[model samples]
Target: MKVFGICGYSGSGKTTLLEAMIALLTARGLKVSLIKHAHHGFDIDKPGKDSWRHREAGAGEIALITDKRWVLMHEARNEEPPQLVDILERLSPCDLVLLEGFKRAVHPKIEVHRPSLGKPPVWPEDCDIVAVASDQAIDCALPRLDLNDPEQVADFVLKHVGLK
Candidate 1:
C-alpha cells in the first residue's frame, strides 16, 4: 500500500485533517486503511467486558467479533511496542494507508501546524515531512497547504504519494 503520515503536536487538529482526508479519498473509491499511534495509555475495552476479562486472565491476545466488525487486541506485556513496519505487515491489502502520529517514524508525512497553538513545527527537524498544513502563513521552504481546505490538501497528498 502507499503509505503516508499526518503528524503534529497535541491539539493541532491532526485527527480533524485525517477525517476529512479519509472522506475525500474514500469518495474517490480508494481503499484506505489507517494506523494511529497513541502516546498515552488507552483502552478500547471496559473492565467488565468479556475481552477485557479474557485479557486479564493472562490471555496474550483477544479477538472480539460482531456482525459488523472484529477487532484484535494484543497485550504488549514486557516486550517493546511493535515497530511501524511490523504493524503494517499485519494489515490487509489496501490502496493507501494514512497514519496519524508516528512523528518519529521515517514515513512521508504532512505536518499539521497551527500558528495559534504556539508550538514549533516538526518539519524543521523531520526530513520526512513533505508538506505543511497550517491555518496561518508560516515561514518554511516546504509546500504550504490551507488547513481549512481539505480538497486542496487532499490534492497535494494524492500528488505527493503518486495516487493522483
Candidate 2:
C-alpha cells in the first residue's frame, strides 16, 4: 500500500487536516487506512468494559468484536512500542495509509504548520517532509499549501504519491 505522513507540532491541526483529507480521498474511491502515534499514554477502553476487565486480568492482547467493527488491543508491558514497519505489516491492503505521527520515519510527509502556534517548522530539519501546509504563507523551499483548503491539499498529496 502507498504510505504518506502528516506531521506537525501539537495543536497545529494535523488531525483536522487528516480528517478532511480522508473524506476527500475516500469520496474518490480510494481505500485508506491510518496509524497514529501517541506521545503520551492513552486508553481506548473504559474501566468497566469487558475489554478493560480482560486487560486488567493480565491478558496480553484483547480482541473486542461487535457487529459493526473489531479492535485489537495489545499491552506493551515490558516490550517496547512496535515500530512503523511492524505495524504496517499487520494492516490489510489499502490504496493509501496516512500516518498521523511517526515524524522520524523516512516516509514522505507534509508538515502541517500554523504560524500562530509559535512553533518552529519541521521541514528544514526533516528531509522526508516534501511540502508544507500552513495557515499563513511562510518562506520555504518546498511547495506551500493552504492549510484550510482540503481539496487542494488532497490534490497535492495524491499527485505526490502518484495516486492522482
Candidate 3:
C-alpha cells in the first residue's frame, strides 16, 4: 500500500483534514486506512470494560470483537512506541494509508500549519515535508493548499502516492 502522512502541531487541524480525506477517499471507492500517533497517554477501554480489566490484569494484548467492530489493545508497559514499519505490518492491505503524526518518521508528508497557533512551520526543519496545507498562503517551495479544502488535499495525496 502507498503511504502518506499529515503532520502538524496541536490545533492546526490535522485531525479535521484526515477526517475529510478519509471520507472523500472512501466515497471515491478507494480502500484507505489510517495510523495515528498520540503523544499523551490515551485509553480506548473504560475501567469497567472487560478489555480494560484484562489490560489492568497485565495482559500484553487484549482483543475484543463483535459483529460491528473489533479492537485490539496492547499494553505498552512503559515500552517505547512501536516503530512505523511495525505498525504498518499490523494493518491490513489498503490502496492508501494516511498517517497522522509520526512527524519524525521518514515518510513523505504534508505539514498542516495554522499561523494563529503561534508555532512556526515544521517544514523549515523537516525535510520529509513534501508540501504544506495552511489557512493562509506563504512563500513556500512546495505546493500549498487551503487547509479547509480537503478535496484538493486529498487529490494532492493521491497524486503524491501515484494512485491517480
Candidate 4:
C-alpha cells in the first residue's frame, strides 16, 4: 500500500488535517487507512470495558471484535516499541495509508506548520518531507499548501505518492 505521513509540532493541526483528508478521500471512493503515533500514554479501552478488564488481568495481547470493527491491543511489557513498518503491516488493505507522527521514519511526508507553535520546521533536517501544509505562505524549497484546504492537499499527496 502507498503510505504517506504528516509530521509537526503539537497543536499544528495535524489531526484536523488528517480528519479532513480522510473525509475527502473516502468520499472519492478511495480506501484510506490511518495510523497514528502517540507519545506519552494512550488508552482506547476504558476501565469498565471488557478489553480493559482483559488487559488488567494480564493478557499480553487482546483482540476485541465486533461486526464492523476490531481492535488489537498489545502490551509493551519491556519489549522494544514496534517499528513503523511492523505497525503498518497490521492495517487492513487499502489504497493508501495516512500516518500521523513517526517523523523519524523514512517515509515521504508533509510537514504541518504553524508559526504559533514556536517550533522549527522538520523539513530543513528531513529531506523526506516533500510538502508543507501551512496557514501562511513561506519561502521554502518544498511546495506550500493551505492547512485548511484538505481536498487540495489530499490531491497533492495522492499525486506525489502515486496513489491516484
For residues 114-142, what per-residue lDDT tens digits would candidate 3 score against the true structure?
98888988998999999999999788898
State each model's CA lDDT, in order. Answer: 0.93, 0.95, 0.93, 0.92
Count backbone overlaps in model 4. Answer: 0
Pick by TM-score: 1 or 4, better one: 1
Best prediction by lDDT:
2
**Residues 69-107 of candidate 1: C-alpha lDDT, one tens digit per residue:** 999998999999999999999999999999999999998
Residue 38 accuracy (lDDT) in model 3: 91
Clashing residue pairs, backbone N/CA/C < 3 A, model 2: none
> What 10-residue stretch in candidate 1 is worst by lDDT?
149-158
lDDT tens digits by residue: candidate 4, 1-164: 99999999989999999999999999999999998899989888899888899899999999988999887899998899999889888888999999999998899999999977778888999999999999987878999999989988999999998877
| Candidate 3: segments with Cα more than 4 A from true spot | none
Candidate 2 residue-wise lDDT, 43-113, digit = tens: 99999888899899999999988999999999999999999999999999999999998999999999999
Model 1, position 95: C-alpha lDDT score: 91
The TM-score of predicted model 2 comes to 0.98
